[model samples]
Target: MTIPTPPPGPEPLRETIARHGLDARKALGQHFLLDPGITARIAGLAGDLAGQNVVEVGPGPGGLTRALLDSEAGRVVAVEVDTRAVAIITELASRAGGRLEVIEADAMRLDLTTLCPAPRQVIANLPYNVGTPLLVGWLRQAAAWTRLTLMFQQEVAERICAAPGSAHYGRLGVLAQWTCRCGVLMHIPPGAFSPPPKVHSAVVGLIPHAHQPDAALFRAMEQVTAAAFGQRRKMLRGALKPLGGESLLAEAGIDGSRRAETLDIAEFDRLARLHMRRAAA
Candidate 1:
Protein backbone atom coordinates (compact mmCIF):
# COMPACT_ATOMS: atom_id res chain seq x y z
CA MET A 1 0.00 0.00 0.00
CA THR A 2 1.30 3.43 -0.92
CA ILE A 3 1.71 5.93 1.91
CA PRO A 4 -0.63 8.91 1.61
CA THR A 5 0.94 12.28 0.97
CA PRO A 6 0.35 15.17 3.36
CA PRO A 7 -2.76 17.29 2.81
CA PRO A 8 -2.72 19.62 -0.21
CA GLY A 9 0.06 22.00 0.92
CA PRO A 10 1.94 23.42 3.84
CA GLU A 11 3.30 26.97 4.04
CA PRO A 12 6.64 27.54 2.31
CA LEU A 13 9.76 27.53 4.52
CA ARG A 14 10.36 31.25 3.98
CA GLU A 15 6.86 32.04 5.18
CA THR A 16 7.21 29.63 8.08
CA ILE A 17 10.33 31.48 9.22
CA ALA A 18 8.85 34.87 8.54
CA ARG A 19 5.68 34.15 10.45
CA HIS A 20 7.70 32.85 13.35
CA GLY A 21 10.18 35.74 13.14
CA LEU A 22 13.00 33.25 12.83
CA ASP A 23 16.46 34.10 11.61
CA ALA A 24 19.69 32.13 11.61
CA ARG A 25 21.54 32.51 14.88
CA LYS A 26 25.27 32.91 14.32
CA ALA A 27 26.01 31.45 17.71
CA LEU A 28 24.29 28.21 16.78
CA GLY A 29 25.93 28.28 13.32
CA GLN A 30 22.42 27.90 11.90
CA HIS A 31 22.11 28.38 8.13
CA PHE A 32 18.80 27.10 6.91
CA LEU A 33 19.01 25.06 3.71
CA LEU A 34 16.33 26.56 1.44
CA ASP A 35 16.93 24.96 -1.94
CA PRO A 36 14.94 21.81 -2.63
CA GLY A 37 17.30 20.69 -5.39
CA ILE A 38 20.29 20.86 -3.08
CA THR A 39 18.35 19.35 -0.20
CA ALA A 40 17.18 16.45 -2.38
CA ARG A 41 20.71 15.90 -3.59
CA ILE A 42 22.02 15.89 -0.02
CA ALA A 43 19.39 13.29 0.91
CA GLY A 44 20.24 11.24 -2.18
CA LEU A 45 23.93 11.12 -1.20
CA ALA A 46 22.95 8.81 1.65
CA GLY A 47 22.06 6.15 -0.86
CA ASP A 48 18.93 4.03 -0.32
CA LEU A 49 17.35 4.76 3.06
CA ALA A 50 14.55 2.23 2.45
CA GLY A 51 15.02 0.55 5.82
CA GLN A 52 17.37 2.97 7.51
CA ASN A 53 16.65 5.24 10.46
CA VAL A 54 18.14 8.66 9.59
CA VAL A 55 19.11 11.05 12.38
CA GLU A 56 19.05 14.64 11.07
CA VAL A 57 20.93 17.08 13.33
CA GLY A 58 19.38 20.44 12.35
CA PRO A 59 16.27 20.23 10.22
CA GLY A 60 15.73 23.99 10.02
CA PRO A 61 12.42 24.99 8.40
CA GLY A 62 11.90 21.31 7.40
CA GLY A 63 13.31 21.70 3.91
CA LEU A 64 15.68 18.77 4.16
CA THR A 65 13.26 17.07 6.51
CA ARG A 66 10.68 17.05 3.74
CA ALA A 67 13.24 15.73 1.29
CA LEU A 68 14.23 12.91 3.64
CA LEU A 69 10.60 11.91 4.13
CA ASP A 70 10.17 11.82 0.39
CA SER A 71 13.33 9.68 0.08
CA GLU A 72 11.42 6.69 1.53
CA ALA A 73 13.48 6.48 4.66
CA GLY A 74 12.32 4.06 7.35
CA ARG A 75 12.23 6.86 9.94
CA VAL A 76 13.80 10.22 10.78
CA VAL A 77 14.48 11.41 14.33
CA ALA A 78 15.26 15.09 13.87
CA VAL A 79 17.10 16.70 16.78
CA GLU A 80 16.81 20.48 16.85
CA VAL A 81 18.11 22.84 19.53
CA ASP A 82 16.35 25.96 18.28
CA THR A 83 12.74 26.12 19.44
CA ARG A 84 11.82 28.26 16.45
CA ALA A 85 12.93 25.48 14.11
CA VAL A 86 11.30 22.93 16.40
CA ALA A 87 7.79 24.19 15.60
CA ILE A 88 8.42 23.90 11.88
CA ILE A 89 9.81 20.39 12.17
CA THR A 90 7.01 19.32 14.48
CA GLU A 91 4.45 20.56 11.99
CA LEU A 92 6.17 18.52 9.32
CA ALA A 93 6.03 15.49 11.61
CA SER A 94 2.25 15.67 11.80
CA ARG A 95 2.05 15.41 8.04
CA ALA A 96 4.60 12.58 7.97
CA GLY A 97 2.20 10.00 9.46
CA GLY A 98 4.69 8.97 12.14
CA ARG A 99 7.79 8.46 10.00
CA LEU A 100 9.32 11.72 11.20
CA GLU A 101 9.85 12.64 14.85
CA VAL A 102 10.97 16.09 16.01
CA ILE A 103 13.03 15.88 19.14
CA GLU A 104 13.65 19.09 21.05
CA ALA A 105 17.19 18.62 22.32
CA ASP A 106 20.83 19.30 21.64
CA ALA A 107 22.40 16.88 19.16
CA MET A 108 25.78 17.21 20.88
CA ARG A 109 24.43 15.80 24.13
CA LEU A 110 21.80 13.46 22.74
CA ASP A 111 22.48 9.71 22.76
CA LEU A 112 21.87 9.02 19.09
CA THR A 113 22.63 5.28 19.13
CA THR A 114 19.49 4.76 21.18
CA LEU A 115 17.43 7.44 19.38
CA CYS A 116 16.37 4.80 16.86
CA PRO A 117 16.97 1.13 16.12
CA ALA A 118 20.15 -0.37 14.69
CA PRO A 119 21.54 0.37 11.24
CA ARG A 120 21.08 4.07 11.88
CA GLN A 121 22.39 6.53 9.30
CA VAL A 122 23.14 10.06 10.55
CA ILE A 123 22.41 12.53 7.77
CA ALA A 124 22.52 16.22 8.52
CA ASN A 125 23.33 19.72 7.33
CA LEU A 126 25.36 20.28 10.48
CA PRO A 127 25.72 23.72 12.03
CA TYR A 128 29.15 25.03 11.03
CA ASN A 129 30.52 25.92 14.47
CA VAL A 130 29.69 22.54 15.98
CA GLY A 131 30.24 20.37 12.93
CA THR A 132 33.81 19.24 13.61
CA PRO A 133 33.28 18.51 17.28
CA LEU A 134 30.12 16.57 16.48
CA LEU A 135 31.92 14.56 13.84
CA VAL A 136 34.71 13.75 16.30
CA GLY A 137 32.16 12.65 18.86
CA TRP A 138 30.55 10.32 16.35
CA LEU A 139 33.94 9.00 15.30
CA ARG A 140 34.63 7.94 18.88
CA GLN A 141 31.62 5.62 18.68
CA ALA A 142 31.81 4.71 15.01
CA ALA A 143 30.30 1.30 15.51
CA ALA A 144 26.98 2.86 16.45
CA TRP A 145 26.40 4.34 13.01
CA THR A 146 26.08 2.55 9.69
CA ARG A 147 26.83 5.64 7.62
CA LEU A 148 27.23 9.39 8.12
CA THR A 149 26.29 11.72 5.30
CA LEU A 150 27.20 15.12 6.71
CA MET A 151 27.70 18.67 5.44
CA PHE A 152 30.67 20.75 6.55
CA GLN A 153 32.67 23.66 5.19
CA GLN A 154 34.65 22.61 2.13
CA GLU A 155 37.93 23.12 4.01
CA VAL A 156 36.73 20.72 6.70
CA ALA A 157 35.63 18.20 4.11
CA GLU A 158 39.16 18.33 2.71
CA ARG A 159 40.61 17.79 6.17
CA ILE A 160 38.42 14.72 6.63
CA CYS A 161 39.74 13.04 3.49
CA ALA A 162 43.19 14.57 3.40
CA ALA A 163 46.21 12.39 2.79
CA PRO A 164 49.09 12.22 5.27
CA GLY A 165 51.34 14.59 3.34
CA SER A 166 48.81 17.34 2.65
CA ALA A 167 48.43 20.62 4.53
CA HIS A 168 44.97 19.54 5.72
CA TYR A 169 46.31 16.40 7.35
CA GLY A 170 46.27 16.49 11.16
CA ARG A 171 44.37 15.01 14.10
CA LEU A 172 41.00 15.10 12.32
CA GLY A 173 42.45 13.35 9.32
CA VAL A 174 44.11 10.69 11.46
CA LEU A 175 41.00 9.82 13.44
CA ALA A 176 38.53 10.08 10.58
CA GLN A 177 40.66 8.15 8.08
CA TRP A 178 41.41 5.42 10.62
CA THR A 179 37.85 4.92 11.80
CA CYS A 180 36.04 5.05 8.48
CA ARG A 181 36.29 5.40 4.72
CA CYS A 182 35.11 8.93 4.00
CA GLY A 183 34.73 11.05 0.86
CA VAL A 184 33.07 14.27 -0.28
CA LEU A 185 30.02 13.42 -2.38
CA MET A 186 29.03 16.89 -3.53
CA HIS A 187 29.57 20.63 -3.05
CA ILE A 188 26.84 23.15 -2.22
CA PRO A 189 27.56 26.81 -2.71
CA PRO A 190 26.87 29.34 0.05
CA GLY A 191 23.84 30.52 -1.94
CA ALA A 192 21.92 27.30 -1.25
CA PHE A 193 21.07 28.37 2.25
CA SER A 194 18.70 31.09 3.51
CA PRO A 195 21.57 32.99 5.15
CA PRO A 196 24.63 32.04 3.16
CA PRO A 197 27.80 31.14 4.99
CA LYS A 198 31.08 32.70 3.94
CA VAL A 199 32.70 29.43 3.05
CA HIS A 200 31.74 26.81 0.44
CA SER A 201 30.24 23.58 1.77
CA ALA A 202 30.56 19.90 0.91
CA VAL A 203 28.58 16.79 1.74
CA VAL A 204 30.66 13.92 3.09
CA GLY A 205 29.85 10.21 3.35
CA LEU A 206 31.56 8.17 6.07
CA ILE A 207 31.20 4.39 6.18
CA PRO A 208 32.82 2.87 9.26
CA HIS A 209 35.48 0.23 9.02
CA ALA A 210 34.48 -3.35 9.85
CA HIS A 211 37.55 -4.14 11.93
CA GLN A 212 38.40 -1.48 14.49
CA PRO A 213 40.70 -2.00 17.42
CA ASP A 214 38.92 -2.16 20.79
CA ALA A 215 38.18 0.89 22.93
CA ALA A 216 41.38 0.63 24.93
CA LEU A 217 43.55 0.61 21.83
CA PHE A 218 41.54 3.40 20.21
CA ARG A 219 42.04 5.58 23.27
CA ALA A 220 45.77 5.03 23.04
CA MET A 221 45.66 6.15 19.41
CA GLU A 222 43.90 9.30 20.46
CA GLN A 223 46.49 9.96 23.11
CA VAL A 224 49.41 9.42 20.79
CA THR A 225 47.96 11.60 18.03
CA ALA A 226 46.90 14.32 20.42
CA ALA A 227 50.41 14.70 21.80
CA ALA A 228 52.09 14.37 18.42
CA PHE A 229 49.90 16.98 16.80
CA GLY A 230 49.24 19.17 19.82
CA GLN A 231 51.88 21.64 18.70
CA ARG A 232 52.00 20.12 15.19
CA ARG A 233 55.23 21.86 14.26
CA LYS A 234 57.34 20.10 16.88
CA MET A 235 59.19 16.90 16.02
CA LEU A 236 57.84 13.60 17.33
CA ARG A 237 60.59 13.46 19.94
CA GLY A 238 59.70 16.83 21.46
CA ALA A 239 55.93 16.44 21.11
CA LEU A 240 55.76 12.85 22.36
CA LYS A 241 58.37 13.25 25.14
CA PRO A 242 55.76 12.93 27.84
CA LEU A 243 54.40 9.71 26.33
CA GLY A 244 57.84 8.04 26.04
CA GLY A 245 59.79 10.36 23.75
CA GLU A 246 62.32 8.88 21.35
CA SER A 247 62.00 5.40 22.88
CA LEU A 248 58.38 5.24 21.75
CA LEU A 249 59.39 6.12 18.20
CA ALA A 250 62.21 3.56 18.31
CA GLU A 251 59.80 0.91 19.50
CA ALA A 252 57.37 1.79 16.71
CA GLY A 253 60.20 1.92 14.10
CA ILE A 254 59.39 5.55 13.23
CA ASP A 255 61.79 8.42 12.80
CA GLY A 256 62.09 10.61 15.88
CA SER A 257 62.67 13.82 13.91
CA ARG A 258 59.63 13.65 11.62
CA ARG A 259 56.68 15.96 12.16
CA ALA A 260 53.09 14.77 12.64
CA GLU A 261 51.95 15.86 9.20
CA THR A 262 53.99 13.20 7.36
CA LEU A 263 52.87 10.17 9.30
CA ASP A 264 50.30 7.97 7.56
CA ILE A 265 47.48 6.12 9.29
CA ALA A 266 49.57 2.97 9.61
CA GLU A 267 52.40 4.89 11.27
CA PHE A 268 49.94 6.38 13.67
CA ASP A 269 48.64 2.89 14.47
CA ARG A 270 52.21 1.76 15.04
CA LEU A 271 52.70 4.55 17.53
CA ALA A 272 49.31 3.81 19.11
CA ARG A 273 50.23 0.15 19.56
CA LEU A 274 53.52 1.08 21.16
CA HIS A 275 51.77 3.51 23.45
CA MET A 276 49.33 0.78 24.51
CA ARG A 277 52.05 -1.80 25.08
CA ARG A 278 54.05 0.49 27.36
CA ALA A 279 50.88 1.42 29.21
CA ALA A 280 50.04 -2.25 29.81
CA ALA A 281 53.58 -2.96 31.08
Candidate 2:
Protein backbone atom coordinates (compact mmCIF):
# COMPACT_ATOMS: atom_id res chain seq x y z
CA MET A 1 0.00 0.00 0.00
CA THR A 2 3.03 2.24 -0.26
CA ILE A 3 2.99 4.60 -3.25
CA PRO A 4 6.38 5.27 -4.77
CA THR A 5 7.66 8.84 -4.53
CA PRO A 6 7.81 11.08 -7.63
CA PRO A 7 4.83 9.17 -9.06
CA PRO A 8 5.32 6.17 -11.36
CA GLY A 9 5.98 5.94 -15.11
CA PRO A 10 9.54 6.58 -16.13
CA GLU A 11 8.47 8.65 -19.13
CA PRO A 12 6.32 11.74 -19.31
CA LEU A 13 2.61 11.23 -20.16
CA ARG A 14 2.89 12.59 -23.71
CA GLU A 15 5.93 10.39 -24.28
CA THR A 16 4.18 7.43 -22.73
CA ILE A 17 1.23 7.94 -25.04
CA ALA A 18 3.61 8.14 -27.99
CA ARG A 19 5.58 5.07 -26.90
CA HIS A 20 2.39 3.12 -26.41
CA GLY A 21 0.89 4.42 -29.70
CA LEU A 22 -2.14 5.57 -27.72
CA ASP A 23 -3.91 8.21 -29.75
CA ALA A 24 -7.12 9.68 -28.38
CA ARG A 25 -9.87 7.64 -30.01
CA LYS A 26 -12.93 9.65 -30.87
CA ALA A 27 -15.02 6.50 -31.09
CA LEU A 28 -14.53 5.79 -27.40
CA GLY A 29 -15.24 9.39 -26.43
CA GLN A 30 -11.63 9.68 -25.26
CA HIS A 31 -10.11 13.02 -24.35
CA PHE A 32 -6.90 12.39 -22.44
CA LEU A 33 -6.10 14.67 -19.49
CA LEU A 34 -2.31 14.40 -19.52
CA ASP A 35 -1.46 17.37 -17.31
CA PRO A 36 -0.36 16.17 -13.89
CA GLY A 37 -1.26 19.42 -12.16
CA ILE A 38 -4.79 19.36 -13.61
CA THR A 39 -5.23 15.69 -12.83
CA ALA A 40 -3.95 16.25 -9.31
CA ARG A 41 -6.49 19.05 -8.89
CA ILE A 42 -9.24 16.68 -10.04
CA ALA A 43 -8.13 14.09 -7.50
CA GLY A 44 -8.08 16.75 -4.84
CA LEU A 45 -11.72 17.57 -5.54
CA ALA A 46 -12.55 14.13 -4.11
CA GLY A 47 -11.21 15.34 -0.75
CA ASP A 48 -9.48 13.31 1.96
CA LEU A 49 -8.93 10.12 0.01
CA ALA A 50 -6.90 8.65 2.85
CA GLY A 51 -8.11 5.13 3.65
CA GLN A 52 -10.78 5.41 0.95
CA ASN A 53 -10.89 3.04 -2.00
CA VAL A 54 -11.18 5.15 -5.16
CA VAL A 55 -12.59 3.86 -8.47
CA GLU A 56 -11.58 5.58 -11.69
CA VAL A 57 -13.26 5.11 -15.06
CA GLY A 58 -11.46 5.52 -18.41
CA PRO A 59 -8.04 6.09 -16.90
CA GLY A 60 -6.51 7.08 -20.24
CA PRO A 61 -2.69 6.95 -19.94
CA GLY A 62 -3.21 6.90 -16.16
CA GLY A 63 -2.64 10.62 -15.52
CA LEU A 64 -5.40 10.83 -12.93
CA THR A 65 -4.64 7.27 -11.92
CA ARG A 66 -1.15 8.34 -10.85
CA ALA A 67 -2.61 11.28 -8.95
CA LEU A 68 -5.04 8.98 -7.10
CA LEU A 69 -2.14 6.74 -6.10
CA ASP A 70 -0.17 9.74 -4.85
CA SER A 71 -3.20 10.86 -2.83
CA GLU A 72 -2.50 7.95 -0.45
CA ALA A 73 -5.87 6.33 -1.06
CA GLY A 74 -6.25 2.95 0.57
CA ARG A 75 -6.52 1.43 -2.90
CA VAL A 76 -7.14 2.70 -6.44
CA VAL A 77 -9.12 0.49 -8.83
CA ALA A 78 -9.16 1.72 -12.41
CA VAL A 79 -11.68 0.44 -14.96
CA GLU A 80 -10.89 1.04 -18.61
CA VAL A 81 -13.01 -0.06 -21.54
CA ASP A 82 -10.41 0.86 -24.12
CA THR A 83 -7.86 -1.93 -24.34
CA ARG A 84 -5.15 0.54 -25.27
CA ALA A 85 -5.84 2.64 -22.17
CA VAL A 86 -6.14 -0.51 -20.11
CA ALA A 87 -2.67 -1.60 -21.21
CA ILE A 88 -1.29 1.80 -20.26
CA ILE A 89 -2.86 1.74 -16.79
CA THR A 90 -1.91 -1.91 -16.26
CA GLU A 91 1.69 -0.79 -16.49
CA LEU A 92 0.90 1.92 -13.90
CA ALA A 93 -0.50 -0.69 -11.54
CA SER A 94 2.88 -2.40 -11.67
CA ARG A 95 4.62 0.68 -10.25
CA ALA A 96 1.97 1.39 -7.62
CA GLY A 97 3.41 -0.99 -5.00
CA GLY A 98 0.22 -3.09 -4.98
CA ARG A 99 -1.90 -0.01 -4.35
CA LEU A 100 -3.49 0.12 -7.80
CA GLU A 101 -5.61 -2.45 -9.64
CA VAL A 102 -6.60 -2.15 -13.29
CA ILE A 103 -9.69 -3.85 -14.65
CA GLU A 104 -10.10 -4.15 -18.40
CA ALA A 105 -13.88 -4.13 -18.85
CA ASP A 106 -16.80 -1.96 -19.82
CA ALA A 107 -17.59 0.02 -16.67
CA MET A 108 -21.28 0.04 -17.66
CA ARG A 109 -21.50 -3.72 -17.45
CA LEU A 110 -19.66 -4.12 -14.19
CA ASP A 111 -21.44 -4.10 -10.82
CA LEU A 112 -19.82 -1.15 -9.02
CA THR A 113 -20.77 -2.55 -5.59
CA THR A 114 -18.44 -5.46 -6.20
CA LEU A 115 -15.48 -3.31 -7.36
CA CYS A 116 -14.10 -2.92 -3.83
CA PRO A 117 -14.86 -2.73 -0.12
CA ALA A 118 -16.66 0.08 1.71
CA PRO A 119 -15.54 3.70 2.23
CA ARG A 120 -15.32 4.06 -1.56
CA GLN A 121 -15.29 7.15 -3.78
CA VAL A 122 -15.40 7.37 -7.60
CA ILE A 123 -13.14 9.97 -9.17
CA ALA A 124 -12.62 10.12 -12.90
CA ASN A 125 -12.55 12.20 -16.06
CA LEU A 126 -15.29 10.08 -17.55
CA PRO A 127 -15.51 9.29 -21.24
CA TYR A 128 -17.96 11.75 -22.77
CA ASN A 129 -20.24 9.42 -24.69
CA VAL A 130 -20.98 7.18 -21.73
CA GLY A 131 -20.64 9.71 -18.93
CA THR A 132 -24.30 10.56 -18.46
CA PRO A 133 -25.42 6.95 -18.53
CA LEU A 134 -22.71 6.01 -16.07
CA LEU A 135 -23.78 8.77 -13.70
CA VAL A 136 -27.42 7.74 -13.98
CA GLY A 137 -26.54 4.15 -13.17
CA TRP A 138 -24.51 5.22 -10.17
CA LEU A 139 -27.24 7.60 -9.01
CA ARG A 140 -29.67 4.70 -8.86
CA GLN A 141 -27.44 3.23 -6.18
CA ALA A 142 -26.30 6.54 -4.73
CA ALA A 143 -25.68 5.31 -1.24
CA ALA A 144 -23.09 2.77 -2.34
CA TRP A 145 -20.24 5.24 -2.90
CA THR A 146 -19.01 7.90 -0.50
CA ARG A 147 -18.69 10.61 -3.15
CA LEU A 148 -18.55 10.92 -6.93
CA THR A 149 -16.20 13.55 -8.31
CA LEU A 150 -16.53 13.37 -12.09
CA MET A 151 -15.87 15.39 -15.22
CA PHE A 152 -18.55 15.80 -17.86
CA GLN A 153 -19.16 17.96 -20.90
CA GLN A 154 -20.03 21.49 -19.76
CA GLU A 155 -23.69 21.32 -20.75
CA VAL A 156 -24.13 17.97 -19.07
CA ALA A 157 -22.51 19.25 -15.92
CA GLU A 158 -24.86 22.20 -16.02
CA ARG A 159 -27.81 19.87 -16.31
CA ILE A 160 -26.70 17.81 -13.30
CA CYS A 161 -26.42 20.84 -11.06
CA ALA A 162 -29.20 22.86 -12.64
CA ALA A 163 -32.04 24.07 -10.52
CA PRO A 164 -35.76 23.98 -11.24
CA GLY A 165 -36.89 26.53 -13.85
CA SER A 166 -33.37 26.79 -15.25
CA ALA A 167 -32.95 25.91 -18.93
CA HIS A 168 -30.48 23.12 -18.05
CA TYR A 169 -32.71 21.58 -15.42
CA GLY A 170 -34.43 18.27 -16.23
CA ARG A 171 -34.50 14.62 -15.26
CA LEU A 172 -30.78 14.45 -14.55
CA GLY A 173 -30.95 17.34 -12.14
CA VAL A 174 -33.97 15.84 -10.46
CA LEU A 175 -32.54 12.37 -9.91
CA ALA A 176 -29.06 13.52 -8.95
CA GLN A 177 -30.21 16.35 -6.70
CA TRP A 178 -32.86 14.16 -5.14
CA THR A 179 -30.30 11.68 -3.90
CA CYS A 180 -27.13 13.68 -3.47
CA ARG A 181 -25.75 17.10 -2.63
CA CYS A 182 -24.30 18.15 -5.99
CA GLY A 183 -22.18 21.12 -7.10
CA VAL A 184 -19.75 22.13 -9.78
CA LEU A 185 -16.22 21.91 -8.41
CA MET A 186 -14.19 23.21 -11.35
CA HIS A 187 -14.35 24.14 -15.01
CA ILE A 188 -11.74 23.09 -17.58
CA PRO A 189 -11.10 24.60 -20.94
CA PRO A 190 -10.87 22.34 -23.99
CA GLY A 191 -7.16 23.18 -24.30
CA ALA A 192 -6.44 21.21 -21.15
CA PHE A 193 -6.94 17.88 -22.87
CA SER A 194 -4.45 15.99 -25.07
CA PRO A 195 -6.60 16.62 -28.12
CA PRO A 196 -8.97 19.25 -26.84
CA PRO A 197 -12.67 18.53 -27.12
CA LYS A 198 -14.96 20.96 -28.90
CA VAL A 199 -16.81 21.84 -25.74
CA HIS A 200 -15.55 22.97 -22.36
CA SER A 201 -15.79 20.48 -19.49
CA ALA A 202 -16.62 20.75 -15.81
CA VAL A 203 -16.01 18.60 -12.78
CA VAL A 204 -18.96 17.89 -10.51
CA GLY A 205 -18.86 16.56 -6.99
CA LEU A 206 -21.81 14.58 -5.56
CA ILE A 207 -22.05 13.37 -2.00
CA PRO A 208 -25.01 11.02 -1.53
CA HIS A 209 -27.62 11.93 1.03
CA ALA A 210 -27.90 9.79 4.15
CA HIS A 211 -31.51 8.99 3.33
CA GLN A 212 -31.70 7.80 -0.27
CA PRO A 213 -34.87 6.90 -2.08
CA ASP A 214 -35.79 3.23 -1.84
CA ALA A 215 -35.96 1.01 -4.91
CA ALA A 216 -39.68 1.53 -5.50
CA LEU A 217 -39.51 5.26 -4.93
CA PHE A 218 -36.52 5.61 -7.20
CA ARG A 219 -38.29 3.70 -9.96
CA ALA A 220 -41.31 5.90 -9.50
CA MET A 221 -39.13 8.99 -9.74
CA GLU A 222 -37.65 7.69 -12.97
CA GLN A 223 -41.08 7.04 -14.38
CA VAL A 224 -42.33 10.40 -13.26
CA THR A 225 -39.36 12.25 -14.71
CA ALA A 226 -39.46 10.40 -18.00
CA ALA A 227 -43.11 11.13 -18.39
CA ALA A 228 -42.88 14.74 -17.26
CA PHE A 229 -39.70 15.76 -19.02
CA GLY A 230 -40.12 13.47 -21.98
CA GLN A 231 -42.40 16.14 -23.44
CA ARG A 232 -41.04 19.01 -21.48
CA ARG A 233 -42.94 21.60 -23.46
CA LYS A 234 -46.28 20.18 -22.48
CA MET A 235 -48.18 20.93 -19.33
CA LEU A 236 -48.12 18.23 -16.67
CA ARG A 237 -51.70 17.23 -17.41
CA GLY A 238 -50.78 16.45 -20.98
CA ALA A 239 -47.17 15.32 -20.53
CA LEU A 240 -48.21 12.93 -17.82
CA LYS A 241 -51.28 11.64 -19.62
CA PRO A 242 -49.77 8.22 -19.96
CA LEU A 243 -49.20 8.02 -16.20
CA GLY A 244 -52.69 8.81 -14.91
CA GLY A 245 -52.54 12.39 -16.21
CA GLU A 246 -54.62 15.01 -14.38
CA SER A 247 -55.84 12.46 -11.86
CA LEU A 248 -52.27 11.72 -10.81
CA LEU A 249 -51.53 15.41 -10.43
CA ALA A 250 -54.66 15.87 -8.42
CA GLU A 251 -53.74 13.01 -6.15
CA ALA A 252 -50.26 14.41 -5.66
CA GLY A 253 -51.68 17.90 -5.01
CA ILE A 254 -49.61 19.40 -7.85
CA ASP A 255 -50.93 21.91 -10.31
CA GLY A 256 -51.77 20.12 -13.53
CA SER A 257 -51.20 23.29 -15.57
CA ARG A 258 -47.52 23.48 -14.66
CA ARG A 259 -44.83 22.68 -17.20
CA ALA A 260 -42.27 20.00 -16.37
CA GLU A 261 -39.36 22.39 -15.93
CA THR A 262 -41.20 24.50 -13.41
CA LEU A 263 -41.64 21.76 -10.82
CA ASP A 264 -39.13 21.56 -7.98
CA ILE A 265 -37.49 18.39 -6.66
CA ALA A 266 -39.94 18.02 -3.78
CA GLU A 267 -42.84 18.35 -6.20
CA PHE A 268 -41.30 15.67 -8.35
CA ASP A 269 -40.72 13.48 -5.32
CA ARG A 270 -44.34 13.91 -4.35
CA LEU A 271 -45.46 12.99 -7.84
CA ALA A 272 -43.18 9.97 -7.80
CA ARG A 273 -44.54 8.85 -4.45
CA LEU A 274 -48.10 9.15 -5.72
CA HIS A 275 -47.16 7.44 -8.96
CA MET A 276 -45.69 4.57 -6.99
CA ARG A 277 -48.71 4.31 -4.78
CA ARG A 278 -51.10 4.25 -7.72
CA ALA A 279 -49.04 1.65 -9.54
CA ALA A 280 -49.02 -0.50 -6.45
CA ALA A 281 -52.77 -0.27 -6.05
1-281, model 2: which lDDT tens digit per residue?
33224344457998778777889989899999988999999999999998999999999999999889889799999999888778778888888789999998999999877989989999999999999999999998898999999999999999999999999999999999999999999999999998999999999999999999989999999999999999988999999999999999998888899999999999999999999998999
Give the lowest summed-lDDT range of ten residues in model 1: 1-10
- Screening candidate 1 with a backbone cut-off below 3 angstroms (N, C-alpha, C), the clashing residue pairs are none
TM-score for each predicted model, relative to the true structure: 0.95, 0.96
Q: Point out where model 2 deviates above 4 Å.
A: 1-9
On TM-score, the leading prediction is: 2
Q: After superposition, how far is residue 279 of candidate 1 from its true place, in Å?
A: 1.7
Candidate 1 local lDDT, 1-281, one digit each (tens): 33333345776778777766779999999988887888899899999898999999988888889899999799999999999889778878888889998899998997788899988999999999999989988998899888999999999999999999899999998999899999989998889887988999999999999987778888999899899989888999999999999999998899999999999999999999889988999
lDDT scores for all predictions? 0.90, 0.92
Residue 247 lDDT in model 2? 96
